[model samples]
Target: MTNEFVLEAITREFPESVLLHSEPYGFLTLEVKKQDIKKIIHYLQDSSLEINFLTDICGIHYPEFQEKELGVIYHLHNMMTNFRIRLKVFMPRENAEVDSLTELYAGANWMERETFDFYGIKFKGHPDLRVILNDPEMGYHPMLKEYKLEDGTRTDKDDKMFGR
Candidate 1:
C-alpha cells in the first residue's frame, strides 16, 4: 500500500514508539525507540500489511555522534504488495540492548549475529549470539570509531601480522 497508510497504521498501533516518519526513495522509514522495538516489530508483522519478510538487519556505530552512539537498522519487505519499509532504533554506546526480532522473523538470526559481531550491540533472546567474522581473541570492535591501531603505529602491512 501507500507510505502514508503504512505510517498511519504504525502510528495508530504504536503511538509511543513512532518517533518520526520519513519517505526517502518513496519507501516508508519509521524511526522507532529502542525500548519499544519488539512491540513495534510485532505490530508490523501482525498488521494487515503482513510485512513478514525481513530482508536485512545491520548495525552502525558512531562514537563521535552525540544523539546515539550506535544504531540498528532493519529492512523489511511486504511480499504481497512489493512494498518496503525500514525501521531504525538508536542506542547509546553503554548498555546497548534491544529486543531480538528472531522470534518473529527467523531470517533475523544471521543478520542479528552479524550486527553483534561488528557493533557489539547485544540482541536480547538471540538463540545463537556469537562472533560471525572476527576471531574470539579480538577484543575491540573494528567497526567503531573508537577503534585504534595497536601502539598508534602506521603501516601498509597487512592486519594479519597484528593477529587478525
Candidate 2:
C-alpha cells in the first residue's frame, strides 16, 4: 500500500496519538505520543495493513531539548510489500521509559535491552531487561550526550594532532 493510505489509516485510527508525520527519503516517519506507542504498533501489526515485521528499535538522547530530551525510534517493515515505516516517541530525560515491544515482537527483547544498556531508556514490562553490551555494574549510559566525547586525561593522545 502507498504511504499516504497507510498514514491516513493510522491517523484515522489514532487521531490523538499522532503528533507529527513526514515522508523523508520516501519513508513514512511518525512522531506519536509515548503512551500510545504500544497500542498504535499493535493496531499496525494486527490490522489489514500487515506491517508485521519489527525491523529495529533504538534510543536517542537530546540533552538540550528538556522535556523531549530522550527518544525511542522504532522501524517496522511489511515484508510482503517491502514497505517500511518509522515511529518515534520522545520523553523527558528524567523519565525515559516506554512500553516494551517484546510482547508484540519477539526480536524486540534484545533490541530493547541494548537501548536500555546504552541510552538508559527503560522498557516497561520487558521480562529480562538488563545491560546487554555494557558491564552490568556500569552506572552510566555512555550513549547519552551528557558524557564526554573524549578523555582529557589520556596523555598518549595529543589534542593538537587531532586539531582540537
Candidate 3:
C-alpha cells in the first residue's frame, strides 16, 4: 500500500503510542513511545498491513538530545509489496532499555545483541544478551557519542594531515 495508508493505519491503531510521523525520501518513518514499541510492532506484523519482515534493528546516540539521548531504530519490510517502514524509540541514557522482539521475531536475537554491544541499549527479555562483537572486557559502548574521535595522546599522527 501507499505510505499515507500505512501511516494512517498505524496512527489510528496506536494513537497514543505514536509521538511523531514523517515521510523522509518517501519512506514512512514514525517516532513512537519506547514502552509501546513491542505492541506497535506486533500490530504492524500481524494486522492487515502485513509488514512482517524485520529488516534491521539498530541503536543510535544523540548526546545533545537531553532525555532522548539514546534510541533504537527498527526497519520493517513487506516483502510482497516491497514496502518498508521505519520506527524509532528514544529514552534517557540512564534508562536505555526496551522490550525484546526476539519472542516475536527469532532473528531479533543477534540484532539486539549487536545493538547492545555497540550502543549499550538493553533489550529486556533478550535470552542471551551480551557483547556479540566487542570483547566482553570492554566495559564501554564504542558507538556512544561520548567517546572521542581520535587518540589525543598519539604523537605519530597529525590532525592537520587528516584535514581535521
Candidate 4:
C-alpha cells in the first residue's frame, strides 16, 4: 500500500536481491540485482502488492561506471491505487543482459526491443528481441556516453547559439 510497506515486503522476500531503495519524486524506486529482477517482478505482480501495470521500460548507459556500464529501468503501476514504483538493474557492458519481463507483461516486448536497439542490452528469453528503432547494421549502441553528441567536423552548426 505505502512505500514503506512495499519496500519492507520486498526486502523480506529477497533481502539479498535489493541493492538500494529510494523515494525520488514521491515514488518507490529500487535498484536490484539484474539477475533477480524477473523474480522480484513476479512477486510484485502476483503478491498482495499487485503491481500489475507495466508503465514503461527503458535503458541507460554509464560508460564511466566500470561494473555498472549499462542499466535498465522499469516502471510499474498499481491501477487500483494509482501507486507507482520504479525498478532498476545495472550490469557491465560486456555482460549487459537481463531476464525479459515479456512473460509477466506482454507490453514489455516493444519496450525491451527499443531498449536493445538503443543501448544494446540484450533481454534474454525475449520472444523477438531485435532493433525496433535503429538500423541493424548500425552495429553499436547509440545511447552510450562514448559517442560524441556533436561531430568535431561539423562546421555548419553554430555552437554559440546553441550554448554548447
Query: What TM-score does each of the candidates earn?
Result: 0.87, 0.92, 0.92, 0.92
Ten contiguous residues with the weakest lDDT in model 3: 155-164
Off by over 4 Å in 2: 153-164
How would you encode candidate 1's per-residue C-alpha lDDT over 68-106 as one tens digit per residue? 889999998989899899999987888777899889988
Estimate, for each residue in 1-164, the C-alpha lDDT of model 4 and write its tens digit: 89999999999999999999999888899999998999999999999888999999999877788899899999999999888999999999899899999999999999999999998889999999988788899898787766556766988765455433
lDDT of each: 0.85, 0.93, 0.93, 0.91
Residue-level lDDT for 27 in candidate 3: 95
The digit string of per-residue lDDT tens for model 3 on 96-158 reads 999999999999999999999999999999999999899999899998877556688987776
Candidate 1 vs 3: which has more lDDT: 3
lDDT for position 68 in model 4:
92
Q: What are the per-model C-alpha RMSD values against the true structure? A: 4.7, 2.9, 2.5, 2.5
Model 3 C-alpha lDDT versus the unseen true structure: 0.93
Q: What is the per-residue lDDT of model 2 for residues 1-164, given as tens digits with 9 covering 90 to 100?
A: 99999999999999999999999999999999999999999999999999999999999878778999999999999999999999999999888999999989999999999999999999999999999899888899998876545687987765456443
Give the count of colliding residue pairs in each prediction: 0, 0, 0, 0
